[model samples]
Target chain A: MRARERILGRLRATALPHPPEPPEVASWYAGRQRNETRPQQIERLRSALEAARAEVHDARDAAWPAIVKGLAEAKGVRRLLAGSGSPDAARLAQALPAGIELVCFDRPIDDWRDELFDTIDAGLSRAKGAIAETGSLILWPDAHEPRTVSLVPPIHFVLVDVGTLHPDFHTAMQAGRWAENLPTNALLVSGPSKTADIQQTLAYGAHGPRELIVLLIDEEGAGK
Target chain B: MSQPINFHPVESFKERGRSVVNDPAQRKNFRSAMDFLQGKRRAQFPERQELEGLRDLASAIRRYSLAQLPTLLEQLERNLTANGIQVHWAENAEDANAIALDIARRVQARKIIKGKSMVSEEVDFNHRMQEAGIEALESDMGEYIVQLAGEAPSHIIMPAIHKTKQQIAQLFSEKVPGVPYSEDVDTLIQVGRQVLRRKFAEADIGLSGVNFAVAETGSLCLVENEGNGRMCTTVPKVHIAITGIEKVVAKLEHVPPLYSVLTRSATGQAVTTYFNIITRPRQPGEKDGPEEVHLILLDNGRTQAYADAQLRATLQCIRCGACMNHCPVYARIGGHAYGTTYPGPIGAIISPHLRGLDQTYPLAFASTLCGACTEVCPVRIPITELLVRLRNEAQARPDSEDATLRGSGAGRTKLATAVWRGWSLVYSRLGLYRMTSWSMSRGRALSPIDQGAWTRSRTPLVPAPKRLRDLLRKRRK
Candidate 1:
């Protein structure tokens, strides 16, 4: 506390005679040209996500469960983890093939830390929204949807509601009013975890999910 | 505990630079990596007009934030506390390390999984943790590789940029158990993933660096491509974030532009794989995320930089390492040659404030005053100008009334001062300048064959046979 006081006090003492006026950030930001229609936004999002090596599938809202089931079976995934209370998880459980099992994150991490880290082949979560310009998934992790669901597993399947997509980060934040109520952890995931650390050679799953598959819920069948 | 590569005399820094420059392999490695990074950055900013607009907006945001730094810091602390995240303050490196060590002791932590935090490097956090008998492991792939080799990061963004794949494979095979020699980057990364995963799950604490702390949202923003940052910050029971106080911005809206500029400048990505914005600890009924979140705002001579308006520009850096990538000096000597936590142009300007001018004055003079750094700076820091100011501060009169830097006038010498004064007199007077140039041209043959360090790589610096002014006069006639 004393350190804080001293540091702040010293800073105050050295304050400029007149604080500089804040820049017109909003006006400047508004001058940029980014007014794409919904389809164009989704197209931009798909291209950017695909460029980052993320698999983006265009699926109807009612058909995503079957798609997830097919993807899981194709990848030979046996154990899939999802949020216990998520309706999408329930739908996935009913749609999964008999050989695959759906596990819910109902227990505290302390109870299933080892299993989550070593046993789960894939994890599922729902992205709150996405940024089309960067193809980033905006994740607001909370009590119902834990943060690790998309991070710990080798494979992660995220459900993105196409209606929630925004043109860019600035638009997303302002439209979502993120500053009014930020969650404990808000994440923007663009692709599968990767690194160029070793001799500048890019490699995926350096510490996070090796694969990120985005299931776009195009209810209107707007995306081809 | 072992100290960081200590600040040595200017001669040793020069010697290290000389050795690295002479090593063709090392020079080639740096040259290729820099070229790759520069090309990627250029590709990202395809439109020069938009890039300039973004740069202007980014610079204004940083300047305004620094101007209102004190208020924003207080707001950040207040809001973070309200949000159940504890906040601690440190005035120097020792204070910062002690605060983190105290937390580790309180938690009875045996191991700490760390994301890349250059503040931790600045405060010598790992060595101090080692002294306290705790293993603060580096979880980032590049950091882990560098840590395994017991060396400092050569580049801010690419920690292991100095080593080749074959070299890394050899290091891993020798250091990591049950690992075979393989130069494949994928295999090496897989090996690292296996080792670090266990450490992340088992470690008692997670430590990270904050890229930007939003005062309005009470959030700590981290920018990274790897999932290790998320794993380290989320997996461990206790999460600790350390950042220089200058990282704070007033609102969340300022983040996107700066984030865009930062990623594009640092690694040529539109966005990293993960951008984590952590506001508080795990809320009620939350199944995961750290239960206890602590933020340490370390001053460590930042207040010194803030005292002066001109030097204050040094604090505007976002640690993108773009200047280093663009620096010809850094490309030749590499980051290790600077012998500071930060290297290149940014390091040269900021180190004087961090570790007094007496120790870092040499760094200020190491540059060629090329504006490449200033040209490429996303926030337009005017790095070359800062370097010149630092050089002046290092050589100012010790007892002068206006001396604002620690170790001011350390570079001053009776002979150098006298020579500079005489130089000013000769150059400022037209007649004296003409007379001196005329005599120097006539006496060119009498000049020394070996002109000290100048002749080390090239021929002697003998005066030209004729003065430039005389040649111009002849051409005019």
Candidate 2:
């Protein structure tokens, strides 16, 4: 407490120079967004995600679950993890074939840390929204869908509703009203985990998912 | 009132600089690495107008944050506390370490996993923890490599940038048990991933650095390409975040602009793999995330920078490391040669306040004043201008009445001071200047050929046959 007082006291004791008002950021990107159509935004996101080595599959709402199952099968995934009590998880379970085993993250991590880290072949979650400009998915981890569901697994499958896509990060934040109430953990994942740390050589799957498979649900056929 | 200086031998910087500059392999490593980075950054900012606009917004946001730093910090404390995240104040390196030590003691933590935190480096946290018989392990792939080799991070962003792949393969095989040597990057990364995964699961405490602490939302934002940061913060029971006090911003809306510029400037990424915004620890019903979260706000000489209005600009740095990558000096000599926790242009300005100017005076003079650092800074820090100011501060009279900087006039010498005074006297008087120039031109033949260090690399500094004024006069006629 004394340290806080001394530090703040020093800062308060000194008068800071008044800076000019910050520029309006909302309009700075306005010109770029003016001519871009919804389909164009989705296309931009697809190319950006593809460039980062993430696989993006455009599917209708009804066919999305089957796509995930097929992708899981193609990857030879045995035990796929899902968020317990989530509607998407329930839908996914109904769509999966009998050959694949479904694992629910029903309890606290302490109950099954080893299983999640070692045994889980893949994890599935729903992205709240996405940023088109950066090809990023926005996730807010909650009690139902814990943070590790998307992080720990070797492969991560995220379902994004194309309608929720924003033109950029600033637009996404404003549209979501994120500042009013934020979750314990909110994430913006641009690609599968990667690193260029070793001699500036690009390598994927550094610590997170090696493959990030995005199931883009285009209900309105915007990209058709 | 006294600022302790970490005095190195006077020629330590030059010696280190010479050694790195002369090594052909190391030079090739740095040259290729820097070229790759420069090209990527250039690609990210293809449109000069848009890049300038973003830079403007980013700089303004940083300035506004610094101006409101004191108030924002108080608000940050209140909100973080209200959010059930413990907040600790650290006035210096010792205070910061002691706080973490206290937390470790309470948690009875044996193993601590760490994300890449430069603040932890600033406080010597891992060393302090080791002294207390607790193991603090670095989980970032690059940091892990450097830690295994028992060395400080060579670069801020890429901690092991100084080392080549072959060297890392050698180090890993020797240090990591049961591992064979391999130069393949993917194979090596997998080895690191496997090793760190177990440590993350077993560690009792996790430590990370905060990129930006949003006061309004009581959140800590961390930007990283690897998932190590998430693992460190999530897998452990307790998560501890450390950051310099200057990292706070007043609102959450300010993050995007800064983050945009930071990623592009630092790594040429549109966005990193993960942008983690942590507001609290694990909630009651949460299945994962840390049970307890603690944030340490360390002042560590930042208050000194904040005390002066102009020096306050130093607080605007977002630690993107663009300045270092674009620096000619850093490219040739590398980060280690600077002999500071932060190296290159940013280090040259900030190290003086942290370690005192008396010992760090050489850093201010190491720059070529090329303005590349100033040009590339995401927040427009005016690095070269600050470098010039610090140089002046280091050479000012030691007892100057209003000396706010520590170790003022450490670089001042009687001979240099007298030389400057005489030069000023002669230049200010027209008759003396004319007489000196006339004699210098006439005595050109008498000029000494062996002119000391300046002549070592180039031709001797003999006076010209005709003065510049005489040449101009002849041109006019």
Candidate 3:
């Protein structure tokens, strides 16, 4: 018998009636702070991200680029990688300090594969939003700032507008209606890559970037 | 039925279990690790109401998905194919391994990299690949350690929980050269990182196990702390994901609650480092991900279990390993003792379905039916109830046509069956019950002290001094 036929037939033959739609999840676990102002949400997000081991820096829109440059200088990053022509990149390049080189991931990672993994000291991208509960940065990877920008390099830097911070993961997914028009790939990265595999001893940077630095752009009056 | 493979638990179940219990170091390793994991889980869900609510939602999602499993599987296959990902179905472990090997051959993959996939382990996958001259390297740190040691994973989530840091340090120094042996875990991790980084970049094919396969979007979701899972699915030219047919869910929103309960229950982490949801192979403009992605939907014997209404609850497992972590028997005996890919309470119920009663029925008896497993189960599988049901199955008639209960335990034979038959006959009838009680009370002195295995560690059970019926009458007077 065809494998698919057999497997599915068995399930079909014994299948029960479909139950009701999944109970409306009590996603309001984060609703306690629903009344909190946007600024409070940002603070909650920053604290959560910090706890997850991602360094968070508060900055204004114009100051965000300078903060990135400063982080580059601090990490001894020579060639700082950013998605070319991205909103975050345009601002960073305009404000980039002279000594540090700004390398645009202008083409596909395949075009500059060797440099991306080896030569690039760090990579940066703009996060779609931040989840305060788990302190995770959600990214919807596309052709422009592909997944690799946040993944391959030794160091990762993410930019998040303070207003984009959500109270929790479910609220973000629910509001976004992600199921309807989901991207080809979506990620929820909490911290720098870590592992406790070797006898439960925690270690960072097992494979992905060793460090995750979040540059929180605080737009004063910005609302969700 | 799952025959005893090179590393399968069937032939070596008792021996391996005995060794695991007798080895103080192994026992200590499991006890401490389980304690730490259980503690972490407890701390994460300090509020009972919140945990129970999430569990309810996750359980509903699992059950609802299973109710429409056939439709959902079809939808998943259709969506994946439309999105340019190939889907294959396997009725059993052998078929699954053969299909995976066929994919490897077509791709001419020499060195394959793998994330921690219990499904792959279920099929004795590494051994199969090696026989075909393919090297399957496990990239997950714990799995890599167990692979290097040439042993099966004792625990599902933490494959190398049986090894201590000192043991791992010793193994690394002995196997991977150029590094001086150090007991420091950070240093040991660095050594592993340096060695595995190259393989991740060079592997010809990447294989991973799916945590969830969404039917609505035709996507596979993976949760992991280390980035190896991402690298394997991304770097290789070809990626093959194998998962049980039971993993598919109805919608995307269902993932969050299930994902939340899973990590918190398994490792006591509020959230894992990464939740990667993949819908299609690298699209046309995409630069990094694999060019080809294939998913193997495996049935094994799950369909047989899924056929029964009550037994279907076993499919609700999310592979969180919480049951094992909180299992007292498992912590003491360790994972390798169960002799199945999955161990502890979940294994006991599920193994019988996949491997049949003859090979894995002993696992049903391995548990004390302690409710710790059932208590912490994310989807709240009635593990203890299932264990009791399986015990009855293990005693079913040997020639029974029931595939779900192939019945190969002590009661399957005629003598054992007759012993129960006569015993039941005496216990159920008033005249026989009175005669047996009177005879047993009068002949208490003649009872043998030794009763074989039962008397090995404890005294034989002795009859009561007086009959319960007579005592009740005296009380009435």
lDDT of 1 by residue, A62-144 (tens): 89999999999999999999998889989999999889999999988977899899999999999999999999999998887
Fnat across every predicted model, in order: 0.91, 0.88, 0.76
Tell me model 3's lDDT, rounded to 2 decimals: 0.84
Give lDDT tens digits, candidate 2, residues A49-159: 999999999999999889999999999999999999988889999999998999998999999898789999999999999999999999988999999989999999999
Q: Name the TM-score of candidate 1.
A: 0.97
Candidate ranking under TM-score, highest first, comes to 1, 2, 3
Q: In model 3, which runs have C-alpha deviations exceeding 4 angstroms? A: A18-21, A26-34, A94-99, A221-224, B1-12, B399-411, B469-477
lDDT of 3 by residue, A154-174 (tens): 899998877777787778887
What is the interface RMSD, in angstroms, for predicted model 3? 1.7
User: lDDT for each of the candidates?
Assistant: 0.92, 0.91, 0.84
Q: Compose the digit string of candidate 3's lDDT tens values, residues B1-477.
A: 122333445567778778878888888888889888888899999999889888988898898888888989999998999888999999988899899999999989999999989999988888888888999999999999988887878888999998988989888888897878899988888888889887877788999999999998899999999888998888788999999999999888788889999999999999998999988888876667888999999999999789988899999999999999998889988887787889899999998788777778778777887698998899989999988888877786556654355444533667777889999999899898889889999898888999887897899988888878889999999
TM per candidate comes to 0.97, 0.96, 0.95
Q: What is the interface RMSD of each candidate, in Å?
A: 0.9, 1.1, 1.7
Which residue pairs collide in model 1, if any? none
